[model samples]
Target: MHVTKEQIAGMGKFERANFINSLSGMKSANLIGTKSEHGVTNLALVSSVFHVGANPPLVGMLMRPHTVVRDTLQNIKDSGVYTINHVNEAMVEQAHQCSARYDSDKSEFEATGLEEQYFNDFAAPFVAQSNIKFAVEVREIQVLQLNQTELVIGEIVGVLSNKDYCLEDGYVDIQAAGSIAVSSLDSYHRTERIDRYSYAKPDEPLRSIWKTQS
Candidate 1:
């Protein structure tokens, strides 16, 4: 199973892509919702969401190069707002179908049987089926010249989640929320609560703070 850089370059497109993407292991599966100025809604499944900073609560996601119409990116540029919704076990099928290149006028929420939700004055829609969702304001977009991929960074402005998913110490119980993760590009998996440990200090033994469910 050893693959060198030369071997990787020689591999077929699909094979090379799948292998490289899967090497990153599991990633958070999220549905990014946006709306055009004319009110057309778009939902796309993304797995590259990652934490950028916490002081200002920033999150970043990578969007594939614009080989075709990029409704989500365009909408965000036009409106400056979007929603990130976690995909759970029950929403896997619908969430995956979002990757299909539907007409820009078509709404994935309606096309895939997921309900659209709105809160406060957010300009984008949210997946009602998701237990954990948040709204963000577009902060910056950086285009990588090497690959032409776009890095979208947003500042989290609001959050909505099931009451049961919040812990007393301000942590989220993602496993209890039923959120799922993605491997490579297509495989979906349910996650389990392993263990949470306290911050490490010099001369102190690492300790687990996680509690087993009664």
Candidate 2:
């Protein structure tokens, strides 16, 4: 269980990738939807989506080296917009299939049988089966020199979710929405609430928000 840097560097490509990816434990699984300038729609499953800032409502995700045809990245660059749809329990299979490398001409929505949805003429598509989704506009794209991976940062412009899942305090109850998490490259998991606590103050006892709210 003691894997040194040398050992890690010497591991097989697939083995190293899985090991490194799983080291981060559970990750948010989302279906990134985009549309080519020519109007071809694309869907890609990405776990790297994360919050960047709250004031500007920014989000970011990493794209693997662009040595190959990256339809989602290209579409976002061309169209300047994309959708992030949470992969819920019901749509896990279809969402995972989106990771497949399909020809740019073929829409993953059609290939996977996932319904495409749009909001107010948004250029990108959303997964109709997802309980929670959001629209993002590209703000920046930086290439990480070390690995050639691209860091795509965007601003969240709109969100779609069931009202019941939106809590009073601005927290979205993703677990209640049946949103699932992914580990490594392929494993899927469901989560349970451990409890919520109030903001911590130095030397102050933590208060259980769940108990007070309930």
Best by TM-score: 2
- Candidate 1, overall lDDT? 0.91
Q: What would the per-residue lDDT of candidate 2 be over residues 1-214, giving only the tens digit for each residue?
A: 6999999999999999999999998999999999998889999999999999998999999998553239898988889999999999888999888888888899999999999998998889999999999999999999999988999999999999999998888988899999999999999999999999999999999988986664
lDDT of 1 at 25: 91
**In model 1, which runs have C-alpha deviations exceeding 4 angstroms?**
67-69, 212-214
Query: Each candidate: RMSD to true structure?
Result: 1.6, 1.2
C-alpha lDDT of residue 36 in model 2: 94
Per-residue error for 194 in candidate 1, Å, reads 1.7
Indicate the worst ten consecutive residues by lDDT in candidate 2.
64-73
